[model samples]
Target chain A: SQELEQSPQSLIVQEGKNLTINCTSSKTLYGLYWYKQKYGEGLIFLMMLQKGGEEKSHEKITAKLDEKKQQSSLHITASQPSHAGIYLCGADWTGATNKLIFGTGTLLAVQP
Target chain B: GAGVSQSPSNKVTEKGKDVELRCDPISGHTALYWYRQSLGQGLEFLIYFQGNSAPDKSGLPSDRFSAERTGGSVSTLTIQRTQQEDSAVYLCASRPDSNEKLFFGSGTQLSVL
Candidate 1:
């Protein structure tokens, strides 16, 4: 089964600092989605990138896909305490059903 | 409902009991999916339903797990004779026709003791 490797597995940063989380895959991704999950809560959709080298931003967060569509990075600028959560990246590569294979996830802790 | 809705936000059952989790996708959406999330783990694909096509159940962990979509709108996931390791967050998501965005439900937290 295809899987995504997200690193660093966990990160802690100052509230005003910038942080970047990376998700890498061996196979080409048809679609990549970024989501945030709070403890004991559902995942919140953040962004989706399909086209190679595509970049999308929402608020202070930005997501970019590599030219090969096999790697993606999420960048958060001037993070706040509210930015602390488990970040997960899901991808579709099989071209099968709408099922997505997710990464192990990055746990971000922003200290105020 | 404005977004995906799941019933029984939390479930606690005995190890040998059967459990059912329900999900109602967004209105008019054609694609529905179920995934399991263990603590500190990624989402595990379970099943998918698209239109009237046969559902894809390739991700189910075992025969103890089964899901069904009725009338193209709602879905139910059943776990029979659950084990202690069956505890996890069951998440449901729905995507509209020709779209990549998947709206997710709040998920049901299942714990088998």
Candidate 2:
């Protein structure tokens, strides 16, 4: 049903430039997670936000969940070549399934 | 301290045949999941197994798609009478618990001709 939507299907930036990716959901998000996958590989977990208005950071990546509880943003500061990959956002809705519904993804190209 | 692992990094098969993919989750991890990723597409949830309980098969695309996890460790996904539409990278993931972050495997690339 495409509950989650992401913007800027693809993005390119200089190696040192900063970038932001957005994710919005039609339904309230019970849990929000961000993951990155390189070419032909598995996704690596980046961060997760459960409560609205919560923010978390890892290294140069900072993620925030809006207080409205239907949106999230991933910010990468001082991006590097290694940051090139597909970034996916997944949401866990209310249910016993707890299954993750993923967005199409955002392809990030960090040009050196 | 190894992460999840999948066997047969790549598989090429013809239609009407059967294929089996294996996944070995991290030791002691109780939650396991199977997902499929079409080329340049988002991950598609297939099935999930938590410990020794009954698996949640609601996401399976069809009756031909079935999976089993034995002894709460190794798991296998089987597809019978495969079609070209079944071609995709099958990914496996595991987490210590339902609330923890998932650890994924490299995945098995299946090409059904």
Pick the lDDT winner: 1
Global lDDT of model 1: 0.91
Off by over 4 Å in 1: none
Candidate 2, A44-103: lDDT as tens digits: 899999898999999999999999789999999999999999999987765546676788
Counting clashing residue pairs in each candidate, in order, gives 0, 0
**RMSD in Å for all candidates:** 1.4, 1.7
DockQ of each candidate's interface versus the true one?
Answer: 0.66, 0.64
Task: Write model 1 residue lDDT over A1-112, tens digit each, in one string.
Answer: 3478999899999999999999999888889999999887778999999999999999999999999999999999999999999999988885645567788899999988
Q: Scoring only chain A, what TM-score does candidate 1 earn?
A: 0.95
Candidate 2 residue A18 Cα shift, in angstroms, is 2.1
* Candidate 1 displacement at residue A87 in angstroms: 0.6
TM-score of chain B of 1: 0.97
